[model samples]
Target chain A: MKVGFFVGCNTAFNRPDLEKAVRYVFPALGIELDNLEGQSCCPTWGTMPSIDLVGWCALGARNYAIAEEKGVDMITVCSTCHGSLARTAYRMQTSPEVRNKVNELLKEVGREFRGTARIRHAVRYLYKEVGPDEITKLLKHRLDGLTVAIQPGCLSLWPKEVFIDKEEDTFHPKVLRELCEALGVSAPHYKQLLECCGMGGMRSTDMEKSFRLVERKMTSMKKEINPDLIVTGCSSCLIQFDTSQEFLQKKGRIYFEIPVLHYMQVLAICLGAEPKMVTGLSRTPVDNIIKRILQG
Target chain B: MKIFEDLQTTAEIALVKNNLAEEIKELGADKLLQCNQCAKCAATCPLVLAGFPFFNKRIIQAILIGARETLLNDISIWACQSCNRCTDLCPRNVNPYEVILATRRMAVREYALPALAVEGIRSLYDVGHAVYLSESGNPRRKLGLPEKPPTTLSFSNALREVQAIMRKTVLADLGIIPMEESANF
Candidate 1:
């Protein structure tokens, strides 16, 4: 199957490995991955409710419009962008009043929103389409000694109106964990597997509250079980946990230098991509995770 | 602590929000008509599990009666993790998640607690960026930032620019004011 990749602004700028990992894994699964240019932020300003919602909607609609032009299904790596674009599409199609209003606004800039495309996050597309059995068959690397704590951010679940899927029993689905196991690793169990990374407006607005939230979760992860890495499904959470550890350490919180790998990035390493290519060193805690995955 | 029943006048707050959002009036009043106070939402709420005082049924009742003061002051709304566990588990799709986020947005405006919302909004107003990275006159080289922070636009100035666009958009009729103009008041 041919798919159009909506490389979100964060992934393009900061977490390039998420994009690289996707490129590496899908070809193995017999899927042709394509990237489109001029894709912008879905601009989820509505999360604050104080920002201009129309501006956000217009920006997001522009993205969907670009993807629709390609005449292929669009896939996004960022859950935040996926949720925003999906909600905009739903609102535009379902509410004629809203569609007319948004279309009217877009007319001024010569961009009319036709709302013809469907957007899916990479995680959802991978699991539902690729299947656990296919993922198991493709594993070439064995990750025997390593254990992982699965962390999925809020945008991936909840607010069911946008997600439109039956809530899975495991927030961080066993699919990713099972994929890891197929590649040879032990998955750790944790209670609040579905907790927010405090990176939402909470972290950007209130550092103390945000840090306290992450600190609390990290502390729990350390005290409860010492996993070899903290693998996550969201780019925002990766930044919050990966880059914010220094701030957490200054506040006297324990340092959890635990590697945070995107699920595809982990799979890439198992598929034998280079440490730099698979682990994404610049914005990741890659050393130990790459070592563990490769050594096994 | 006052529990809203003790408030002197809730009518004014209700009128302001209702005048802005008709759906608020419906959600605030009509939606709770079938509510039997089963406590199912409260019991299953992720917030309550996290020790937050969010009682889903109680919030619905409070909104129904136009008791904005009580609902605005409650910590239950912010405490919601937005995990939607309660909404999903609810026998009725009471949708506690939507209710809490709406109420919290209203409360942020009502209480003028933009500062309480996060330092980001304030910084976004003061400087172009989201947070207050440094002081106004601090040497740019010392901080290691790329350059000096952007100029500080007055809160009102920033609000005016955002409001101008919101006024013409579909969002204008949504009843959310976008920003609390006189938060100090």
Candidate 2:
């Protein structure tokens, strides 16, 4: 099985370690990942999509055309990418006029969005395609005695009808939870599990307000489950949760810290990828957790 | 920017009737009339939870009252995470999130966007990604990957394709960012 890798912005620039984790995990499990050669951003919420509908769909269609030529679906660890690309595809597939205008924009670039390829979130892809059973069979390490609070990044699950992979009950998504469980960890519920991580537009606009959201989620995680680690399926969520703690602590808003990792980073460690490459760039330290995962 | 400061009196509401709502609908919130002020969207919106003065319901309220300048002058619209939780939970099928986005489009036309949003658009035009870090080379190389991940950064031609596509969009007329004609795409 092979797929195109659409490495979105935050993953490539803000946290390349997550990129390394994805690179390490996919091939280790016998799924070949194509770079998709010329993929770009999802154009994220703050950019094209917010500016013009055709521009957003045009950029997305260009990326989709690259994957279509390869005759495989595209996948990304970033939920923003999953949301952007999937929503664009849904728009074009449903509206002929939108597709025509987008295709006209793509026509200048010598490409066309045939609406053939779909964008898949890497975690959801693993959950549905690889299955937890096949995943456990390939692991080199396990997370026994570990408890986690899952941040099922808002974009990956919501506006549910537009996405390729969806939670049966979007209000209560379980894909990220079950994926964490496959690693031998106990993933539990948190009250603010579905809240936005204050990334994208919110973070870019007013970080104080952004931190308000993440701090609320963090407080809930610390109080309700008080899990050993925070596992999220979105790259932007990883950046927000992993980096905002120090500021939150400095403000005396929160009294504690919790280590955060994207699910792929944790999977990479379990697959025995070097910790330095897979999880090194985290802001909230993961030293003790890494040590524990390696010892077992 | 207190929202109630822009609250329309009965006479003022008669003078400005549904103008902003029509503009929002044309921008992409085509289902503007469907919203019945259910406030179901407001109940679940992160913007509301984060205490933004104008959230899904309030933003709609602002639009219905033709508070164009009131909506534009404030940064609350920019703070929307676009998580679409409001869209997901809305009983009216209003897709309140699109209304937020449509409001953003209206702001862009009036040059009311935040500097960071402008920076993001500038960055997207230059790098084919909205969030490009010039200092990412060392971290990427330290991880045994290329200096630039295989994106438009690694492929100059792809960057040109992105620029060409950008040129054809509304961005061209807005002139929010510099889109030089360097590529034949």
Candidate 3:
């Protein structure tokens, strides 16, 4: 099967290592990926979406049109991209007036949003297209004896009607957990597993308040799961968890640090991609986890 | 921690600012009045837990009471994660996240937005990515990826396409950022 890889801003810039990981794994698994050249931002919440609903759909439709013209579905590792683009398409399809207005704007560029394309979260895409049992067979390395804290991230499982690949239970999500299980790891439950990572707009606004959320989540993970690492499905949550612990530690907000990686990065290592190409840019030291995983 | 009981009894804060709720509806919160104040959205909102004074439920209450200036002056509205958790749990189908977002639209017109929000918009316009970083090249190179991913960054025509599309949006009319005719992109 084939899909367009929606390389969002954070994955492209802030965490290209994750970008590299996705690039490595998809081809290895024999799923062809189209670049969807000239694809723009999802025009995140703080941008067009905050400006106006029609404007939000217009910009999102621009990106959506790219995949539609390519005649393929899209997938993103960023929850914000999935949420924004999914909701944008949902709006375009639900309202004829909004669809006509967005298409009117798209006419300037000689493109129209036909609403045939869908943006699937990368993890969800894998779970649906390539089931976990097949994934387990493809692993070059296994994560045996490792315990993990799972972060599904908000956009992956919320406002369920808009998403094409939704959780069976929104609040009590289990897809990420089952995906982790395929790697031969134990992903136990934590209270703040589904809480927002204070990434995106919240982090961009009041960082101190944003870190308060990280503090709460890390605190819960420490008390409840106390896993060796944290694995998240969303790139925003990945960035927040991978980058927040240092500032949080210096302030004495927490006494310990847990290494973090996006699920794709770990899977890349399991698929035998080099660690430096996947986890090299990590802020929190993941060398130990790398050594452990690679040893198998 | 006051919890917005009866719209806060502060003498300095005014209520019923006259059709602020109506103005918000025009902006996109068409279901702004459908809310029955069940507070389920607030219970599920991250902003409320983050100690922000104005959040999903409270922002709706503030707007319903026509508290325009008060909502504009507060930065809490900008901090919403837009997770739609509040939107998911609301039984009345109010879509409280849209209310907070509509409040942001009103705030943007009045120039009540935070500096970073403006920066994000400017970046979105200039680079086609809301969170562009010039220094990301070296790190990307180290990872064996190109200095720029095959996004609008690497392709000039792509960047121009994004600029062309953004020009037709309400953002162009609001004049929030300098959408230059000849930007250095």
Candidate 4:
């Protein structure tokens, strides 16, 4: 399966290791990754989406057009890009008036909104295309009984109408859990499993309140599941959980630190990619988890 | 006697209809009127629990009744995380998150947006990415990848196209960024 990999701004800049992990895993599994060259930001929710509908859809269409021109669907590791791009595509597809208006706007820039390409988040791609069974067979090592607390991130499961890959039960999502199970890891349930990681535009709006949300989530995970690791499908959530633990600890709000991993990073490690190349830049140490995965 | 007198005074007041709900609907929140004051959105909202004065539930009611001034003067609308939990769970399919976004768009028109929001918009216009960092290339280089990751940052022509699209929209009218004629295509 060939696809255009939309490495969003955050994944490209903030966490290149996650980009490295994607580069490592997909080719190893026989999926070809194309750099959708000259692509811009997903424009994120805070920018064009907040401005006006046409502007939002126009920007989103430009990104979608890049992949559509290549005759392949686009896939992103960031849930924000998946949500923004997919939501915009939904708006353009469902509302002909919106489609015309956005197309008019796109016409100025020499692009069109054909809605030909599909937008898939990385985890959903692995779940749907790669299939957990195939992923399991491809793994050089299993999780070896590691327990993980999963944060699917909000975009992967919200406004179900727009997303092509909506979970069967959005309120109680199973894709992330099943993906982990396939890797031979235990992803136990927690009350705040579907809660926002308080990242995205929220952290920019109010850091204290944002941190409070993560603190509440971490507190719940520490109490209910107390898993060895926190795994998330979104890059922003990965940063939130990885970096916020330090502030929460310094504030004496939490007593323990649980290592965090993006699903691709974990999959890369399980696929026998070198741990240092894929995960050495993590804020919360993964040395122990690396030892555990390597020993098995 | 005093309570009766206060009630009489309250009844003498006029109810203002500012058409804020209609404005929000026109801005793409068509379900703004479907909300029946159900607080299910509030039950799960992080901002509501975080003590923001207006969240999905209250923001809907405020807009329906044309409480335009109250919304414009408040910071709660800008604080939405855009997680869409409210959108996902609302029984009326009101899409409270869209309402919040429309309210934010309304806020932007009046220059009532938060500073961070302005910065975010500015970054998108200036660098073609909302979260561009100058030092981002150092890390990409360390990862054995190109310093620029095939985005608008690497392709100035794509950035110009993005800028051209933004110029034709409300962004130019909002005056958030200068749209000069000299750069016309």
Give model 3's docking category.
Answer: medium
Please tell me how candidate 4 rates in CAPRI terms.
Answer: medium
Task: Report model 3's TM-score to 2 decimal places.
Answer: 0.96
Show model 4 residue runs off by greater than 4 Å. B1-16, B180-185
- What DockQ does candidate 3 score? 0.72
Candidate 1 wrongly placed segments (more than 4 Å): A45-58, A107-116, A164-172, A281-284, B1-87, B100-185
Per-residue lDDT over A168-200 for candidate 4, one digit per residue giving the tens place of the 0 to 100 score: 988889999999999898888998887888887
Residue A47 of model 4, lDDT score? 86
Model 4, residue A98: C-alpha shift (Å): 1.2
- Model with the higher DockQ, candidate 1 or 2: 2
- Residue B87 error for model 4, in Å? 1.8
Q: How does each model score on TM-score?
A: 0.70, 0.95, 0.96, 0.94
Question: Ranking by DockQ, best first?
Answer: 3, 2, 4, 1
lDDT of 3 by residue, B1-185 (tens): 34334334321133244678778888888777666677999898889878888888888878767777888788899899989998888876889988888889899888888888899999988988999989999999988888988888878877887788788777788888999754565
Clashes of each: 2, 0, 0, 0
Write candidate 3's Cα lDDT for A125-238 as tens digits: 999999899999999999999999999989999889999999989989988899899999999998988888898898888899999998999999999988998999999999
Q: How is the predicted docking of candidate 2 categorized under the CAPRI scheme?
A: medium
Candidate 3's displacement at residue B29, Å, is 1.0
Q: Which ten residues in a row have the lowest lDDT in candidate 3 chain A?
A: A50-59
A19 in model 2: Cα distance from truth in Å? Answer: 0.3
lDDT of 3: 0.88
Please state the i-RMS of candidate 2: 0.9
How well is each residue in A1-296 modelled by candidate 2, as lDDT tens digits? 99999999989999999999999999998899999888888878889988998899999999999999999999899888888898899889988999999998898899999988999989999998898988988889999899998998888988899988788999978888888888999998888887888887888777888889999999998999999999999998999998899999999999998999999999999998999999889889999999988876
Per-residue accuracy of model 4 over B1-185 as CA lDDT, tens digit each: 56545533432231234567678888889877666665899998878766678899888877766788999988888778777788878987889999998988887888888778778787787777888888977878887889888888888788888888898898887797666533321
